[model samples]
Target: MSKNSSTATGTSVSSRILLDAVTKHYPGQSKPAVDGITLEIPAGKIVMLVGPSGCGKTTTLKMINRLIEPTEGRITLGDEDVTNIDGDQLRRRMGYVIQAGGLFPHMTVAANIAIVPKMLGWSKEKIKNRVDELLELVSLEPAMYRDRYPRELSGGQQQRVGVARALAADPPVLLMDEPFGAVDPITRQRLQDELLRIQEEVQKTIVFVTHDFDEAVKLGDWIVVFSEGAHIVQYDTPERILNEPASSFVEDFIGAGAGLKQLTLNRVRDVELAEAVTGSPGEMAQDVLARVKEAGDGHAVILDENRRPLSWPSRRQLSRLETIPATPDAAIPLVTQGSTLSDALDTMLVSSAGAALVTDRRRSFVGVITVEVVMEAITRSRKASAMANDNDSPVGTNTGTIEVQGGTT
Candidate 1:
């Protein structure tokens, strides 16, 4: 498997989650809210529960941590039977994030993240270090944001803090319920990209619930399509779910342009980025233009003192200037290697040069992703998906069902 690929095993500090014949029936309802469902969430992999409104996806997620008690069946985490465990104790071992961050307006960012650790009786010094570490992990500078109240932060920033709080105790499992649904489209995309990047580092077992099918395709290693009453419409990888719909219900749920959706499966690192002529700020524009001409390139990427991208100027723009500008261009399009091809394409579409700059984890410029590269990636992905669907080899199959035996699955 690739570095970004999801598997059953890795260097995960997490445990697998299993639900066997789990059902949740309401007090007075004629039918159960969540019918009998059996599912296995692999260690360190993200499993997404997706369906229309009124479906039991959210109910199923809450039952894992016993936020809502299950009327029947077993819930196991690793080797332990947690179905009947103390609800408060069980919840402390898992991280949960909900819509709009669910932050308390009165608390500062550091205090918010320190809730779980403090409840666990961690020392003040330890909690402080943890808060700073988590804040940095979520791409927020600790010193600046830690002292601010939740009401002072933007919607996306508040969501990042919520995630930080959930991971405060370094729990083995994470449960998210439409965590990014409340944000604007652009911020939502950034949050998705940030989540993927963070998952690469933490590798926790994440069970996410969303009504958006496209969100499921982008974030989930395994997707569980749920019908009304929480029936398992299809439990499979995103690739299989898109290429081979189990029923007409799934086909309509996927809606139009299944081929276009395949672009979400691949990442920017999967393709070879085109190299651009690079120069530093305060460097002679004539020298940089010479290198651009020698390389047969139309643009040159300007770098700051730390080797971070500052601007991407064309040959024409460079010819009129004597030296590269010291100030960074706020409008420069940027994407990280972990970003999906779909996101890279979106960034490039709004760029005047029809390309986006590729950055490393440190935000340093690596290369350029052009429209042609994205188009080629989309084409290759379509062909690969088609070929996989035609073959009977079961190469990419991931049936999320595990047989329970001896109190374990």
Candidate 2:
């Protein structure tokens, strides 16, 4: 395949997008909407432009595709100057997604996705293949959704269609402006997960614009905190920004739950898990009790023949039991290694058990995490952050593509 062409079903080759002192000024506005902003959006990673409303995040994004022209400075895609490129051709080569999908009311899902491919004069066979590929890419069943109109789908499903449509021609860069903002919180989270999954496969150079700092932290490989006039307050990986705020405004923008938010970046695998005593279903109550006693914890996690978690017998029942309960309730919440610390905490809260059973990707028993363990982990993290703040440079900050530079927004 040619360097410019993408595979039929996977990640496309991507190129870096750069802006040098890019500024946008509306004719009547006294001050520029976006002023003297210089940023390099790295290839094959999601770069988020986030700030409060009227901060010029959207204006900065529109300038990349020439939807809103830059008044000063220059924009470049790889080695080519965007100012010198034809607007129509430039846009077609880059995918654009907006809120609520912006789908045509009259168009079917397949037709919506096929719009770009059709415009590019692809053969009917190629367009059909591309439509099927994208529908599955976004977790929608191609056979069921292909012929359905946008109105027939749910809000979340429609948004998926919008993503599919944007990716129809396999553009190397994707520009998304609040694409998941219209859905409910639950749906929005699902959409975020879907986007992450899709990115793993497509590897598009994605520029996402949002007002929510949590969303930015969750989605961005590198985050650009924008203030008024598109001024960049901080440009760095989420970890450094959370641990070391460049200014008072950034710390305030990060808000009160900064430490807890940072926990989301650390997965369950980051912590050393405590081993829980386990027993087979047919094991005698005395044997199980002995194993639990040896571990110095009164709790025991029962496992089935397949090594899957079965239950955590209540303390009251365990006290008087002569034999292991055959029908023990499997009320213990289970979490995978890939789950975040925040995710484990949520499960513990929901189950009211103060603990979560961890499992491998294959669903086999691994270990458990208690409330005490989580608290200790948080304390350790805080101390580390405090130490890092007191000292000079932090680890993993100097050489990465996204550097934390000192500047005002």
Candidate 3:
């Protein structure tokens, strides 16, 4: 995958959160805006808060950042007591993103992005570099957008700037509230991909909130489903949530197409990989052994001189001088380099031949894609969806009846 390709997975951070009976109440309300809810967000990962509008999902999210002070319980980040930390100090170290980019109409994009850095009193050179870095990080060109005012940009651009601004100070934690909510669907998806790429490179602890169930499934490392008064109906991985819901409430909320929703979290392939080793398709085997001495398993992946997959050699073929076509299973076909990780995984699983050839849409082999890469891609895709919504279909669950609450919706 290209560094910027949709499926990049390299992370060292462990994004974790611990909330002990966190609750928020309005003065006149009979029930808490956020009821007694306890949850954990794993470190260096994206945890999504998803539910209906009045479900207190947003309220649950805000309490973590102290945007809305919890009326009860504690919020902890890593091992620190976030509830007691200085709110301003806590915020500076955390990334905050809201809908429509929240860019200041009066400020240039660079200046809007520079707000956090300037507050942190970073040196002029430091802030300038940070601003530039953030623009590129969010896929916005620095030279193109730095001097432009928010009014001059489109909604998506503004949101990108907002994200750039939130990430400007390089906070270890991120709080996102529908960061892509204000844009058109296509633009939202593009932004979602861009954010995924960014998360892969930056590995921050992220808490993302979305109203869409599909978005929750697509982007979450773990999803926390809420209902009236911020009740946590379920807190689990997207796969688990799809396969096993917390209750009928959770099922009803996700609605009629949960199986199709599964595809959003899955691709044609995941769960496997092909080792990064190859051999010449038509070369002499005893000679090829001299080239790749440690392929280990008494077999070598045969490739054309141009690096396209040909076949996997049998032990006999490994020593034979005469040409014998190896099992087609020897060489697996790869789909697009950045096709959904689930698709690649599905291809590998369905092919059932150890590994599959990873190719672009043109059917040219890029390299071998194994289950490992597919899993990594799944991780990245889920992380990307951590901040977005699973608003579309999943990988392949779209066949027959989709039982809601284990029954028909």
| Highest TM-score scorer | 1
lDDT of each: 0.85, 0.79, 0.68
**Candidate 3: which stretches are off by over 4 Å?**
1-15, 268-409
Q: How do the residues 129-188 of candidate 2 rate in per-residue lDDT, one tens digit apiece?
A: 999999988878899999999889999999999999999999888999999999986567
Q: Estimate each model's TM-score.
A: 0.88, 0.75, 0.65
209-294, model 3: which lDDT tens digit per residue?
Answer: 99877777767777777767766556667776776565678778779856446557654334343455566545556766654556
What is candidate 1's TM-score against the reference?
0.88
How accurate locally is residue 98 in candidate 1, as Cα lDDT from 0 to 100? 95
Tell me how many residue pairs clash in candidate 2.
0
CA deviation > 4 Å runs, candidate 1: 1-14, 284-294, 315-326, 385-409
Candidate 1 structure quality by residue, lDDT tens digits, 51-157 = 88988999999999999999988888986889768899999999999988999889999999999999999999999999999999999999999999998999999
In model 1, residue pairs whose N, Cα or C atoms come closer than 3 Å (at least 3 residues apart or on different chains), thus clashing, are: none
2 against 3, candidate with superior TM-score: 2
Model 1 per-residue lDDT at 286: 99
